[model samples]
Target: MSGRQEQINLDTLEPQQLAQVKKQLDEELEHLTNSFAQLHAAQNKFKDCLRCVKSRSGAPEDIGTGFLVEKKLKSAEKFYESKVEELGNNLKDLEVIVQRKQTNARTIEEVLRQKILASQGQDQQQA
Candidate 1:
């Protein structure tokens, strides 16, 4: 629950432990949000680079150094393409983790809160 890259950590808790689980869920969701933002920025940058490469390719290269620049751009284009795929995969994984965590925390919190309320009602009735 350090809010790092990894997902939720519910270890070392009692069977019905809830607070720590909630904490881990919150941290995981936040981490996923941050990662998604980073991936989006990378995707936009890759698109910009792609546009530049395409535009340059259409230019009539009637001078030296054009080939070199084109070659460099090709290499960069490949790199960006691979990066886009990688980021997309990462985004998908984080999305799954976040969704799972959200469901689990909500379920557990609802159960625990209801249990607490029921116990309070019993105590008042007995008093």
Candidate 2:
């Protein structure tokens, strides 16, 4: 990378432009949040099913039926575990995106603050 600093004046954007960017970030964050909630719900459902399966009564009268049920439940548990892992990976990706957008918003805010202070200094100087 070159040692020369690249000048990026975020203040060059109009307030409307900043607002639009903020809105986009907010909408994306909201969507990701909803997705996480849905994923959590799915994970919870799987956990609940697993718990229910584990708590089943081991009665000798239903040995054959119990074996079939246990086999199916084990298969379902494996499937749900894989799905949970996939959802977790997706959740991690969304979190990273959200973090990046937050950083961008903060940087823009700092730039706007600087612009305001600079304008104030100019006004004071003109006085």
Candidate 3:
């Protein structure tokens, strides 16, 4: 997986299977967390490079490959900027997914709690 969200039919899963799915979601969330950190570091590196490029004087070779290198560097800066935007969007999406998963897990927990409470009530009444 590209650390992207998968479509799960939560209604079709048994409680045990839902727990398994939650575990898998947790693992995926951990992976995405690391990926986010790495992406942020890479974004910082790209920003630094862009700053360095912008601060430099004219190319050393007044009319040759130095100029070409400078041009390519500018092009690379644009590319990196686009990549950063894309990563930011991905991060946002991942956050939304994490939130949804948490909500679902909480809902499941509440349901389980209610079931336990009901079972206890029944036992007390029988006793």
Clashing pairs counted in every model: 0, 0, 0
Q: Mind giving the per-residue lDDT tens digits that candidate 1 earns over 17-117?
A: 66666776688778778877888888878777777776675434435754665566678888878877887787788777778778887876776677678
TM-score of candidate 2 on Cα atoms, chains taken together: 0.69
Q: Look at candidate 2 and give me any clashing residue pairs.
A: none
Whole-model lDDT per candidate: 0.71, 0.70, 0.69
- Which RMSD values do the candidates have, in order? 4.8, 6.4, 3.9
lDDT of 2 by residue, 1-127 (tens): 1246454466687655666766776787688678778877887787677677666655335356556655666677778677767777876777786677678778877766676677789999999
Regions of candidate 2 where Cα sits further than 4 Å from its true position = 1-11, 57-67
What's each prediction's TM-score? 0.71, 0.69, 0.65
Comparison by TM-score, 2 against 3, better one: 2
Off by over 4 Å in 3: 1-25, 59-67
Give the per-residue lDDT digits (tens) of candidate 3, residues 25-92: 67766776777678778777877776776776665444564466667667777887787777777767
Task: Name the candidate, 1 or 2, with the larger TM-score value.
Answer: 1
Ranking by TM-score: 1, 2, 3
Ranking by lDDT: 1, 2, 3
lDDT score for residue 40 of model 3 = 72
